[model samples]
Structure formats: structure tokens, C-alpha cells
Target: MEDEILGKAYDGRLMRRLLAYLRPYRGQAIVALVATIAASALALVQPYLMKVAIDRYIAQGDLAGLNTIAVLFLLVLVGSLAFEYVQTFIMQMIGQRIMFDMRMQIYGHLQRLDLRFYDRNPVGRLMTRVTTDVDVLNDLFTSGVIAVFDDVFTLAGIMVVLLVMNWKLALVSFSVLPLIVLVTQWFRRNVRDSYRTVRVWIARINAYLQENISGMSTVQLFRREAQNYARFDEIDRGHRDANVASIFYYAVFYPAIEVVGALAASLIIWYGGGRVIQGALTLGSLVAFIQYSSRFYRPISDMSEKFNLLQAAMASSERIFALLDTRVVVENPAAPRQAAGGSGHIVFDHVWFAYRGEDWVLRDVSFEVAPGERVAIVGATGAGKSTIVNLLLRFYDVGRGRILVDGVDIREMELDALRRLFSLVLQDVQLFSGTIASNIRLGNTDITDAQVRSAADAVHAGRFIDRLPQGFDTAVAERGATLSVGQKQLLSFARALAFAPQILVLDEATSSVDTETELLIRDALRVLMGGRTTVAIAHRLSTIQDMDKILVLHKGEVRESGSHQQLLAARGIYYRLYQLQYRDQELRAVARTDAR
Candidate 1:
């Protein structure tokens, strides 16, 4: 929908911002402009040289002068070609550099943006901004912006020559100027509408493809292939129709310009011929007028084309600037306090938070974890369990209360310093494309190969790693598709352990692994949790029964807090949850016995 909104063809505000990217390469851009001007001047010389060759040498029957003029004409052609190459090469190189800088700026800004921004924007749409929209601006830089000057110069030079040579004939040639303006306006308006449609469909196509491709396994398991194909076909058809419609405008516009140019040429011939017969205009001058008339319409048509390019760039720039201008809701303090180094003491002082307005996910939540204490949070789905971890990491600032680490509010601490205090492992492990050892180290050069192997062995992940052909050097596919869910979880444990953070935060870390795999890591979990503050969120009560403390969350409030055995004796929410799991286990046991 944002793509559907087409702003002005030339927005001064957007133009100013867009030009700032060119500022860095201003020297190269100047060189390119100079070359463009030189090329335009050289091009104008060729037509006049032709007039001189015909009128002065051929008509006068002077063979030597004709040969000299021919040599000069060839030299001008060569000079023009040389200047054209210099201009094109310089502008293209500058465009690429600006594109690189802009993308880096965009990606860096994206990295600094808070999670709430991601919650509001889709990955595909943001990707379009970085890739597609930036590409549109690149075209403006290389082809539209610098090249427009050449057209303007050529048009002006041709008009001045025509007027100076024969003002009456030049006036006759300019009679069709109004018709050219009308045709260009018609083309620009229609093409702009079609271009907007095309942009909207492109964004839709990208969003649809990213979603379906990422969830292809689900689509296949549910046998929705044909239905997905139908939806994709519809989006594809819309994009195709939008392109074809734009092509129709282009198809009509160029020919109409040619017809208009021909009319101007016809007028020059008729008017200039009469003046020549009456001995008012020289034959050489008449020929030059005809040649200049032909050259005049070309820049006009090119100017129209550049106008469309300018319009597309304006639309693209609006979107890019909008993304860049999005205010970071959660930001680091200007004068941040240094976090006091200790063994992780966290306190949530009556914290209140809502992702959306007034729809509280965590309400007046209060808790504390002493140094090296292992605390477990248990609740139903959507009971604000993960929100606790998110808040602890300062992913989103709390709405109404303060979260403090070592007697300092987290908001007052540097973001990197605050987040570095903990290592998080989630139920869904995100493994990038790299080797097993690289994924473990995660670009942290301080984590040597020995440390990587030790962390893997501590988590019992080395059991599988050793059996592989390449061992620790084994390659991981995208999202670790080559590994089982349990194996990926083991690597995640190894990765978290290698970091050696002061706090270990596990949010449903063992929820996806099987019982055997979970058992494999029980001792590893102890090793990871030993002498380090641990906060684990688990749906399976058995996995967290040995935790130092367990906090039961009901709805958005903390209902009870105690050890597992203490909470079980009270017979409240924890007891009911335990009874339900106990019943299910009993049923499963009975079924196994019957089968045997």
C-alpha cells in the first residue's frame, strides 16, 4: 500500500536528500559532467562540419578543402566517442559506490532499530527497500541525473545555432513545439500510473514468495501446493499486466515523437527551400537548418524519458527515506552508566509492559534472582513468559517500571554491555550457513578451536560431531536443515556455553528435543548452569523440578513463587499443571503396557 502512493514527479525535499549521497563523489560527478558537456559540444560540431563540407568544398569544386573538412569531421566523431566513454564510465563507477554506501547505512540502521520495529514491518518489504528501491536510485544517478544535462545542453546549442543561422526558418521549425509538450505530458501521466502499479505488485510478489518458501515444508505436509500455485499465479499475473501496460505507453510515445520530428523537418525543408530560391538563404545554411532540426527533437524525447526516470526515483527515494527516518523507539542513554561487574543479580521492580496500547502482556510483574541462582518460570502459552526474557535483555523498554542489574537501571546501561551479560537459547535454533566450528564460535575470534571443541564436548554435542566425516569442520545448511532438531539444540547449547556469559537464559530450550536427547544434555545443563545465574522456561515440569526456585505465572501476574516441592505441596496452579502432565504420562504408560 505504501508503494501505491505516487508523490510528485520532482519532490524538492526528496531530491535534496537523494543528492546528499552524491556529495561524497562530488569530484567524480564533476568530471563526468564536464565530459558530458564536452561530448555535447563535439556532437554539435559534426552537423556544422557537414554543412561546410557541402557548401564550401563540394559546391566550390575544391577537392583539397573537402578532404580537409572530412578529416576534421572524423576527428570530432572520435573526440565525441572518447568523451562519451569517460562520462559513462565515471558515472557508473560513482553509482556503484553510492549504492554500496547507502546499503551499508540502511543495514546498519536496521541493526540499531528495536525489535518493535521488526514487529511492525515484514522482512520482505524491508529487503525490497535495501535491494529494489536502492536500485531505482542507482538508475537515477547513472542514467537520469547526469545525463539530463547533456540533453539540455544539446537542445540549447541546437536552438541557438538554428536562430543565429536563420531566425525565420528556426521559428518555422519550432511551430510543432506545443504538440511535443502535449504528447510528452500524456505519456508521462499514463506511464507514471502504470509504474506505480508495477511497484506495488513487485512488493506483493516478494512478500508472498518469501513467506511461502520459508514455510514450504508446512505447505507440503498439508498438501497446499496447488492452492499456493494459484495464489502465486494471481500475483504474477498482476505484475505482468502492469508491465505490459507500461510497455504500451512506451510503444505509443516514441513513434509519436518521431512523427512530430518529421513534421518539423518538413517545415524546415519547405520554408528554407523558398528562402534559398529567393537568394535570402545560402544552400549551406538551409542544409544545416535541416540537420539541426532533426537533432533538436531527439533531446526533447530523451528529456521526456528522463522525466519518467526522475519520477520513479522520487517514489523510491520517498520509501527509502521513510525507512531511514523511522525513529528508534528504544535507544541507549546519552550518558550511559557502566554496568558493575558481578555474578548476575537481576530485579524487576513492579514492571509493566504492553506490546500494543493498554493490552498488557506483563502487568506489575515483580521478581528477583540472587547471584548464581537458578530460577524457572512456568506458565501457559501467552502467559508473558518470553516477554520476561525479552525485557531482561532490554529488547523493549518497560512501559511503567524499572529493571535493574547490579543496582543500576538497564535503560541507563549501554545496550551492548547490557545484552552481553546473558546468552540466550530458544526453542527454535537459528543456525547460519557455515561450518560446525564457525557456528559455534559465531565470528568471535577469541573463541579458539580448542574452546569450540571443549564447549561442544561439555554439551555432549561432540558425540554426534565426532561421528561425522569432517567432525567439527562439517558444513551446516541453511537454518541447520542438515541436522535434526535435537542436534541443532545441542549445538545451540554449545554456542551459548562457549560465550561464557554471566547469565544463562533458556526459553523453552528443551521443548523440541526428544526424551533421549533431552536426557543427554541433563548433565550438560548442570555444567552450563553451574555457578552461573540461570533462568529457564520449560513446559515440561520434570526438566525443571530440580531448579533452585520456580515462579508460577497466571495470566499476566505472578501467582506463586517457591521451590518445585514447596509449590507442589500448596496445591494451586503449579499443582494443577503437574497433575495434567502426570495424567498424560500415566495414559502413555498404560498404552505402552497394553501394546507389550
Candidate 2:
């Protein structure tokens, strides 16, 4: 949750980097610029027209020109307003479109980043880049860049008009411009800092809130609710302080500029009146010079505010570009590599892997599962049991060796196509936020209600599902909280059945079920796994006792591989593991009998 850009908000290089997004919307942006130039040009004519009307009609008695001049002035005003509207509308549309495309690109990039990125970065921080970061871009384009264009043209035209009318009065009036620019730029810098602080504290608050709410149950269980609330209060107060400081700067900015502007106007009037009385300058020209002075520095005030928004946007841009630059490590082969004969035969030739390349988690692991045959992987904690499955699924690639499916290297196949070949029931079943039937048919568009019911029946889950109020359509609460652990496992079983995959993987599928329920589901699993390439990771050795072959692993390598009776006769690692689970089962049965 630490601030990513607290010290870098005002970096010129970083700010310039953000402007790159404007390139894509350049065509419409040009139209907005043209509109602004037209509007500012039209605005500069008003002051001169007023000067001519004052001296010509009143002093020279030229009343005949008034009606025509008034009509032309009205036309200019109407045209200027139309151009202003079009400019604002078009710039806003272009900015919004850029934001839309930027979000899509960032989101697509996020999807491709490896899972390890999420493990390191907080979700709240990433969300800030999308929501608040995009909002800053909106402000910069609408309220910042557009204002800069308007101010530049208006000030330049006004300065030219002032020099043409009376240079002496213009010189005296603009004496205060230096102080105004200095004070306004100072205020803008401070405001940008305060806003940066505000964004940082807000991200901290979001991170704290997300962690607290998602782990609410753990806090209650540990009686740490009071501690979490106190931490939240600290984060909230930091955000409030940052906000109040930003407001203080904004409150002082406008009034300070007003004082400076009024001072300049007073000096203009004092010198211009003397010149007019002495016949050094005409009254009409002196009046026009005063108007020009007012119009020139008007954009200074605008530029000050726009600069503040630009700084915040640059901070956001840095984070977004960083995300887009992340490289996706997993990719399909350049040329398609299809399975040979498509029988789903799997072979691991000396597979070895480590997440960080620091420890040898899986070492020289080799096994082969024939098509339409069943094999079980058995190991203790940290024994590379799940690692094997992760490799097969390509969640991570094997570091040292080749894994082949149907005589073709799995790495050469498309990730999605490879995954679609298998139906998996993980030990930790993840039931999404959807109805029971919908969860079972995830990503499967062709699964019918009848098919869903059959899958449920095959797993012996229909009994409990049929008892529910909504039956197949019943909503599973977040992570299936409303159902028992066994019920969730049953739903996972039904989901796997619906996939009808060529290869089936069941990782401790019966561990959560009660003995009675387990017996029924075990029979169902046996039938489902029949005539498929089945790979099972089981802790309860009994579940795999009837598997066609068993692989017993220790540390990172396989210690034994044989049939159930063959491994038992070896009196090795598999023998000891079988003996342990068998003794535990006996003890559990005796305890149940004595209690009854």
C-alpha cells in the first residue's frame, strides 16, 4: 500500500510520458484545437469593438456606424459560442474514447500477466490504477489541456491588441504579472503535492478496507475486530488530513490572484488618465489597453489550475504503463501441435520444477499413464504431489524436462486446448458465485438440464440437491458457504462429470465426504473414471487401492511404482504409507463403535 509516486508527481519526464495516450485521438483533438483558436480569436475582437464605439460614436459623434457595428458584434458572439461548444464536445468525446481504449488495453494486459504478479501486488492498488487513474486522465483532457489552448490564443491576441492601442499604458498595467505568475505557480505546486498525498492515503484506506472485509470471519474468530477498527481509523484520518490541506490551497489561490489583478488595474487607471488629460494618448485607446491587460493574464489563472490536474494524471499514467509493460510468460506455440491419435496418453520424461528456481520441488519425476487407464500419485506434505498436476495442467511449465500427451510435447499445444482435454476436481473445490446447475456447467454451453441431472445422480449429489428449495437452480453462496463441505465437493463432482473430458483428475475427492456419503460417491467416481485417462492425487491411500497402478513419491522423486498388491509386498515406502492409513481407519471405527 505504500505510495508509488509520492516523490515523482512533478517529474517533467513522467508527465510527458502520459501525453502519449493523446496520440491515438489526435484527429478529433485537432478539431478541438481549431475550435478553441476560433473562439479565442472571436473573443479578442470584443475589446477593440468597445474601444471604437466609445471614442468614435461618443467623442467623434459617429452615430451612423453604431447599428451596423452592433450587428457584426452580435454575429461574432454567436459564432464564437458555437465554436466553443463544438470544441468542448469534441475534446470530451475524444478523451472519453481514449479512456475507454486505454482501459481495455490495460485490462487485457492484466489478464495475460502471470499469476505470480497477483501474488506480489495488492488488488486494491491495481484497482486504483483503473478507476482513479482513468478519472485523472478525464480531468487533464477536459479541464487542463483544453484550457491551455484557450488561454494561449486569448492572451497572445490580447497582448498584440494592447501594444497596438497604447504601449505605455500596457507596460504600466502588466508590471504586476510577474508576481501573479510566481504566486499562482507556487500555489499550484503545493496543491499538486497535497492531492498526491490524498491519493496515496486513499489507496491505503482502500487496501485496509479490502483486507478487513474479505477476512472478516478470521478477525471475529481471533477476537481481533477491535484492532482492525483502530487501524482503519488511523488510515481514514490520514486521508482526511490530505484532503483538508488540498482545500486550503484552493481557497487561497483565487483571492490572491484577484488581489494582484485588481492592483494592476489600479496602476493602469492612474497612468492612463494622466496620459489622456495631457493629450499623450486618446481616452478610447487607453480604455482598450486596460481591457487587454485584463484579458492577457486571465489564462495564467487557468494555467495554474490545469497544471495541478496534469500532475495527478502523470502519477496515474506511470502505474498504468507499468502494468501494460508486464510480459506474459505462458504462450502457445507459433505453430499448432496436435495430439497424435488423440488417445490422451501422457508421459513425463524426467520432469523437474521449482517456482523460484531456488529449490528443487520436483526432481527427475517420470511416469506414464496409458489411455483409458487409472493411476494414483501418493506423497506426504511437500512431496510434489500437486506439483505434478500443476505441471500437467500447464499452470507452470516443467523446468528441466519434457511432458508429452499422445506423443506430442504438451508445451507445443495451445493452453486452452490442453486444459479442455481434462476434467479436474481439485482438493480445494472452487464454486463460483452462481446457481448449482450453472456452476456445474461452467464454460459448457451445451450442457442440458437433463445432462446436469444425470451428472448429479452419478455423483450421488442429487439426493441433497433435490431436497433444497430451488434444487438445481439454488444459488451457492460465496465459495459455497451455504452448503456443507461435502455438499460443495459433490457439486464439484457433478461439475467434472458434465465436462465429459477425455482425461479425468480427482485430487482427494473423497476426503471431505462422510464415510456413508464417501462410499456412494466412491462407487460413482469409479464408474466415471472408467475408460478415461485418470490421474488421481490421493492422501487417503484406500481411495487409490484399486487404481490400476500407484506411484509412491518421497521428497521430489518417485520411490516406488507398482500395483496395489505388488507395492504392499515390496515392504517399502508404499507399505509404510498403507500401514499408517489402515491403522487410522481401524482406530476411527473402534471409536465410533464404542460411542454408539
Candidate 3:
């Protein structure tokens, strides 16, 4: 629906913001503008030269003068071509530079936006803003903005030449102008609607494709390939039909302009030919009027096309600026305080938060982790266990109360400095496309090859890395698709270890791996947790039995807090959780023994 709103064809405010991108390239834009004017002037000269050659040289049987005028005509043609090339090349280069600058700005803004923003917006829609919408603005810069001057200058020059030659014939030529206006208005209205439809369907196509491709494995596993294909075909067909309808308007518009031009030419010939017979107009003048009349319609047609470009650009700029203007709900402090280093003490002082209004995900959740202490948070689904971890890392700020690190409110510290103090590993490991070594270091130049291998070896990830032909240099596919789930989890651990943060946060980090892999990781966790303040969130109660403290949450509130034995002795929420897992494990053991 947002895509369907085309807004105005020429919005002054949007145009100003779009023009700001040109500020850095104003010099090149000026050059292109001057070249465009020069080219238009040169084009106007060609027809006049025809009049001069016919009336002064050819009519008087003067071969020498005719030859001279022909040479001048050739020179004018060459000059025009050169200026046209300069104008086109310069504008194209400026467009490309603007696109680069805009994309960088958009991506930087996206990175700064809080997680809540991502929770509301879809990835496919954002991708359209960066890729498709930016491309439409590029067309405006290269073809619609500065190049419009050529059409205006040519149109003005042609009108002046027509009136100077013969006012009566010019009036006859101008009679068709009203018809051009009517046809253009009709074309503009219809084309704009079709263009909006095209944009909407394209965005839908993009969103559908991104969703299906990312979930292709799930679709295949469920045997829903045929259903998904049918859905995609429907979306693709909508995009195609919208485009064809837009093409239909274009197909009718151009030929209509040509027909009107031909009518103008016919009027000029009919009226001017009689005047020549009446000794009021020269034959050369009549020929020149015909040429000028034909040239005049060209700019009119081009301006109509440019109008469509301007309209499309206005719609695109609206979307882009909306995204850029989204206020960052979580922002760094203006005068940020430095986070105290070497101490990972964190405290949540009666924090309250919600992803939506008043429906709290976490309420009055209070806890603390002293430096070098290990804490675990356990809860049922939607029990606010991970919300506590999210709050500590400042992914989303608390609505009430505050979170502190090292006795200073995290809101008072620079975002990057605060986040650098902790390394996070989640159940779903996210690996980018790169060599195995690069994924571990993640572009941190200080991490050396020795450090990378040591981190992998410490976490037992090197076992698989060494098995690969390229070892640490092996390339990883998108999302680490080439690696097993356990292998990916190990690499994630290696990554966190390589970063060597003062605090470690694991959100169900080992849940995806096998029992053998989990045992290897449990062994490595002893070394990883030593001397580091670690916050672990887990559904498996076995993993956190030895933690210094355990917080049990239920329905957005902490209901129990103690060591494993203390909570088990009380026989409350934590005791019930332990009993459930213990029974499940016993049943699994019995089943395994019976099968043997």
C-alpha cells in the first residue's frame, strides 16, 4: 500500500533532499549542464544552415558558397555530438557516485537502528529500499534532472526560430500544440497509475522471493515445493502484468506524438507553400519552418518521458527518506562516559521492558553478576530468560528502571564501547561467506594466525578444521551451510574465544549440537568460563548445575534464586524443572538399554 502511493510528480521538499546528494558533485553537474545547453544550441543551428544554403547559395547558382555552407553544417554536427557525449558521460558518473554515497548512508543507518526496528520491518522491504528504490533515484539523476535542460532549451530555440522566419506559418504550426497537451495529459495520468502498480508488485515479488529462498529447506522437508512454486508464479505474474500495462501506455504515447508532429508538418507545408506562391514567403524559409516544426515536437515528447521518470523518482525518494528518517529508539549518549575496563560486574536494577505497549516481556527483573562469577538463567518458553540477556547487552533499553555495568548506567556509555565488553553466542550460529579463519577473527586485525588456531583448538573446533583440506583457510558458505550444526556451534565458540571478551553471554549456545559435541563443549566451557563473568541461558538444566547462582523466571517475574541444591531442596519452580528433565533422561536411558 505504501508503494501504491505515488505522491506528487514534483515534490519540492523531496526534490531538495534528493538534490543534496548532488552537493558533493556540483562541479561535475555544472559542466554537464553547460554541455547540454551547448549541444541544444548546436542542434538549433542545423536547420537554419539549411535555410541559408538554400536561399543564399543554392538559389543563386553559387557552387562555391554552397560548398562553404555544407562544411559549416558538418562542423556543427561534430560539435553537437562531442558536447552530447560529454554531458552524458559526466551525468552518468555523478549518478554512480551519488548511489554509492546514498547506499553507504542507508546501510550505516540500518546498523545503528535498534533491534525493535528490525522486529517491525521485514528484511525484504529494506532490501528494496537499498537496491530497487536507489536505482530509481539514479535514473532521476542521470536522465531526468540535468538532462531536462536540453529539452527546454531546444524547445525555446525552435519557437524563436519559427516566429522569426514567418509569424503566420508559426501560428499554423502552433495550432497542434493544444492537441499535444491533451494527449500528454492523458498519457501521464494513465502511465503514473500503471507505474505505481508495477512498483507495488515488484516489492511483493522481492519479499516473496526472499522469504521462500531463505526457507527452501523447510519447504522441501515438508514437501510443499509445488505449493510454493504456485505462489511464486502468482506473484511473478502480477509483476509481469503490471509491467505490460505500463508498456501499453508507452506503446500508445510515442506514436501519438509522432502523428501530431506529422500534422504540424502538414500544416506548415500547406500554409507556407501558398505564402511562397503569393511572394510573401521564400522557398528556403518554408523548408526551414518544416524542419523546425519537426524538431519542436521532439523536446515535447522527451519532456513527457522525463515527467514519468520524475514521478517514479518521487515515489522512491519518499520510501528511502522514510527509512532514513526513522528515529533510533536506542542511541548513544551525546557525552558518553567511558566504560570501566577489566571488570565485568553487571546489575539489573528492577528493570521493566516490553516489545510492545505495556505487555511486558520482563517485569521487575533484578539480578547481578560480580566480576569472575558465573550465572545461569532458566525459564519456560516466554519466561523472560533471554529478555534478561537482551537487556544486559542493551539490545533494547528497559522502559522502567535501568541496567548498570561496573556501577555506571549502560545508557551513559558509548554503544560500541559497551558492546565490546561482551561476546555473545546463540543457538543459531550466524556465519558469513569467508574463509574459516576470517569467520573466527571477523575482520579483527589484531587476531593473528596463532591466536585463531589456538581458539579453535581450545574449543575443539580445530578437530573438524584440521580434517578439511584447507584447514583454517577453508571457505564457508552462506550461513555455514557446508558445515554440520555441531561444527558450526564449535566455530561459534572459537569466534567468541578469539574475541576474548571480559564477559561471555551464551543464549542456548549448545542446544543444537549432539551429546558427544556437547560433552566436548562442556569440557571446553570450564576453561572458557574461568576468570570471566559469564551469563548463560539454557533450557537444559544439566548444563548449569554447577553455576554460582541460578535465577528461575516464570511469567515475566523471577520466582526463585539460589544455587542448584538450595533451589532443589525447597521444591519450588526449579525443583519441578529438574524433576521433569531427570525423568526424561531416565526414560531415554531405559529405552536405550531395552533396545540393546
Candidates in descending lDDT order: 1, 3, 2
lDDT tens digits by residue: candidate 3, 1-596: 57568888899999999999999999999999999999999999998999999989988999999999999999999999999999999999999999999999999999999899999888877887999889999999999898788998898888888888878889999999999999999999998888888878877887787888888899999999998899989989999999999898889999999999999998888989999899999889999899999999888988998999998899899999999999997899999987666599999899899989999988898888999999999999989888887888889999899999988899998888889999998888899999999999999999999999999999998999999989999999988999998888889899999999999999997686788999988877876888899999989999999999999999999889999999999999999999999999999999999999
Write the candidate numbers in order of decreasing TM-score.
3, 1, 2
RMSD in angstroms between candidate 2 and the native structure over all alpha carbons = 2.8
Task: Give TM-scores for every candidate, taking all chains together and pairing residue i with residue i.
Answer: 0.98, 0.91, 0.98
Q: Model 1, residue 584: displacement in angstroms?
A: 1.9
| Alpha-carbon local distance difference test for all models | 0.92, 0.83, 0.91
Q: What is the lDDT of candidate 3?
A: 0.91
Predicted candidate 2 versus true structure: per-residue lDDT over 268-381, tens digit per residue: 888888988999977877777777777766688887777666666776776777778777776777996888688879999999998775598999999999998899999998
Could you tell me how far off, in angstroms, the CA of residue 20 lies in candidate 1 after the best superposition? 1.0
Q: Backbone collision count in every prediction?
A: 0, 0, 0
Prediction RMSDs, each to the true structure: 1.3, 2.8, 1.2
Q: How accurate is candidate 1 locally (lDDT)?
A: 0.92
lDDT by residue for model 1 (23-45), tens = 99999999999999999999998
TM-score, candidate number 3: 0.98
